[model samples]
Target chain A: MLRVKNLTVDHGAIRALHGVSISIEKGQLAAVIGANGAGKTTLLRTLSGLNKATDGSATWGDLNVLHSKPESLVRHGISHVSEGKSVIPELTVSENLDLGALWRRNRKESAQSKNEVVELFPRLGERLSQRADSLSGGERQMLAIGRSMMSKPQLLLLDEPSLGLAPLVVEQIFQSIRDLTNSLGLTVILVEQNAIGALKIADIGIVLNLGSIAATGSAAALRDDPAVRAAYLGF
Target chain B: MFEFVNTLLIGITAGSIYSLMAIAIVLVWRSTRVVNFAAGGIALASTFVGSTILEITGSFWIALPVAMLAGAALSAFIEYFFLRPLLKRSGDKNQEIFLPIIATLGILGIMKAVLHFIYGEKIGVLSPPLSDKGFIVSGESIALSPLRLLILGIVLLLMIALTLIFQRTNIGLSLRAASFAPEISRLSGIRVDLVRTVGWAISGAAGATAGILQTVNGSGAVTPEAFEFSLLLVFGFVAAVIGGIESLVGAVVGGLTLGIILAIILMYLGSSLVFFAAFLILILVLLLRPNGIIGVKGGRRA
Candidate 1:
């Protein structure tokens, strides 16, 4: 389980995340829905060691998530996919995937992981030799998710995976993410602005407002809640 | 006709050395987004080390590799101790490269001052390892010499090795990925900082090779304030820019083009016109393709 307690983060003098806390159990898909500047990205970045927290304690299993560096976190099976498209555009699809497994020294295991990633996103397999920039927006998102899987992470933190993507493509990506959690038993903390779509697939939902959690419950309960719908889910 | 062929050969020989220097500059720029004006100083310092090694062992072979290693060490040191903190503190903003450029210029001055203090008006001799006498072709001594051939061979080999490393090796993948996107590379578990240092080391080695070759290819001696070294740095920078600063292949093309054109100008036009010709050529190329010959259009700056 990943547990965060009173995580406080500052952007210069301004507090981006204020005494926020959330927990995600293993194999559970948790969606963090919030408006712009709600500190969703900052929260994920702090968890992945990209942003420094002013005061916080976060633990992923036995590992102290706050103390670890971003690179070290990946080694400990915590992979983060940043907002928008995160794949290296200059690198070919295959090369990008290889990079995802860079810290994995065992050749056999790395190859097996590559195979699994390719199987999960067959579109990626077809475009393996092509440069990532040449891929479509949806395809780039798939490649990013598939590349993250190459690390075989126990906890995947995705920031705005559905941002700027078509609704049909977003459905496909959400379905794939759901499958990842369901079949692979991967724990996920998905940060999104698309509240309704994210809550539809997430097992648990946390609504963030102005850097603090406004509501947390099962995805169905949060979706059905009148207050959450009116404020965030937009009916 | 014979004079034309000889000039072409000489141009190619000189251009090959410039290509190494250009490659060095390009590597450092891509990795750190700094033009590394101190590249010339690194080369000069390492060449002095090679000269000292030569004095001790009397073996050019031993001196060359040692100098390359010393260059690599110095470059890595500067990147680690100086540029890394400075860049971090300033934030990795590409538009703010002006500061790094000014900072590198300061480093260049410091390096030259240090070298001057150490050497103290003493000249370091880096005589050609192989025979400098041109080959006899139809009873005429052409400009192509054994030492020039060796220089060409070494430059070609280094280029090939670099290409293979960037294309085939995992470390190369990290280097490419880190330069392209440091945050994403870190997420992929690659130590972006270490990879950047490695890039600097390679660039230093390349610059060292160029320095040693330039000395041997020209006056066979170097001083702390050698004008030739300054010229090498300027020409290399120009070459890198002409080749589209981002691509390795562009560096080679830029270097060769600069060398050959300068040679032709020196031979037919006049020696005085050579320096100005470099800028004129650059402006012309930029006019045609603002991104340089091999640079991407509307690409991300730095």
Candidate 2:
């Protein structure tokens, strides 16, 4: 289980994530939907140790992840795939996937993880020799998620995976996310601007407005909620 | 035909050394976004260490590896003490690359002064380990000597090793990932700081090899104020720039092109035109392909 309480983050004086609180059970898929600059990315970055939390208590299986090094977070079975398709463009697709398992001491285990990720995204299996830069937007995002899975994370955080991708591509990516949570028993915290799509695939939905949580409920209830639909879902 | 062949031999021999230096420059640039002007200075210092080792052990082979080790240590120290802070302060801006370039130039000046202070009275000698007598072909001697062949072999081995490291290793992936996208790499759990230091170490070792080769290949001596060392720095940078300064393969091609042209110029146009011809070649290439011969087009300022 993951727990975040009274989390406040100030990005060089402009407070980004307010004193927000949330709890997520293991294997649960939690989608965070918000407007631009509503601190959705900030929340995930802080959770992943990319941003310093001014005040917060985030406990992941009894570990205080606040202010820890980003590398340390992955060791504790947590991984964050931030905004944009974040694969190393200069490296070949195989090399990029290899890096995700770098910290693991057991080479055989990382190889197993690589096999799993490749099984999940078979396109990566075909493009192993090609450079990551040659990948299309959808393919790059797939590589990014595939890389995160290479770490064999118990909990994964994704930000704007559907950004700039076509509707068909977005559906395919969200389907993978669904499969990850349902079959692999992986917990997920997804931050998205595509509220409707994210909510449709999500198990629970949390809405953020101006760096504060506006609503939280089951994905169906939040999708049906008139206030959430009027503001975020575009009812 | 003999004259042309001799000229080609001379160019290839000299170009291989320049390629070593250019590889060092490119490695440093790719890893830290700094041109590493101090490379020349550090190499000079490492040569002095090589000279000391040569005196103690009386073996060129032993001196060489020690010098390379000294280079790696000094390079890592500079990265940890100097470049890391400067980069963190500067961030990854195209314009900010100039800051480190200038900072490295300042470091170069300091290293020159320090080497002069330590070894000003007597210059260090690095005699060729192998015979310099050119191989005979059809009753005429060509420019290809055993020493030059040895130099070529060493450079080839290093390049091959580098290729393997970058293409087939995990550390290479981390270095590439960290350089290309630090925030993402850090998120992916790569120790970017440690990787940057390692990159500098590799660059330093390459620079040290260039220094030893450049010293023995020519007058067989090194001085803190030697104009030859400065020429190495300049030509290496020019070669790296010509190669597009981003890719290792580019560095090799640029070095060979610069070297062959200059050698040919010296053969026909006089030694005076060699430097002038180099400048002209650099200008022509840059004007034609601003990004370099093999540099990526429209990429970040590499």
Leading candidate by DockQ: 1
Off by over 4 Å in 1: B91-96, B283-288, B300-302
Q: Estimate each model's TM-score.
A: 0.97, 0.96
State the lDDT of candidate 2 residue by residue for A37-95, as single tens digits: 99999999998998899997998988898968889899888899989988878777998
Which residue pairs show collisions in model 1?
A: none
DockQ of each: 0.68, 0.66
Indicate the worst ten consecutive residues by lDDT in candidate 1 chain A: A102-111
Q: Per-residue lDDT of A63-158 in model 1, one digit per residue for the tens?
A: 999988899999999999999889998899999999999889777988999899889899999999999999999999999988899998999999
Instruction: State the weakest 10-residue window (summed lDDT) of model 2 chain B.
Output: B293-302
Clashing pairs in 2: none
lDDT winner: 1
Weakest lDDT window of 10 consecutive positions for candidate 1 chain B: B293-302
Two-chain complex of model 1, DockQ on C-alpha atoms against the true structure: 0.68
For the second chain, the TM-scores of the candidates in order are: 0.96, 0.96
**Candidate 2: residue A115 Cα off by (Å):** 1.7
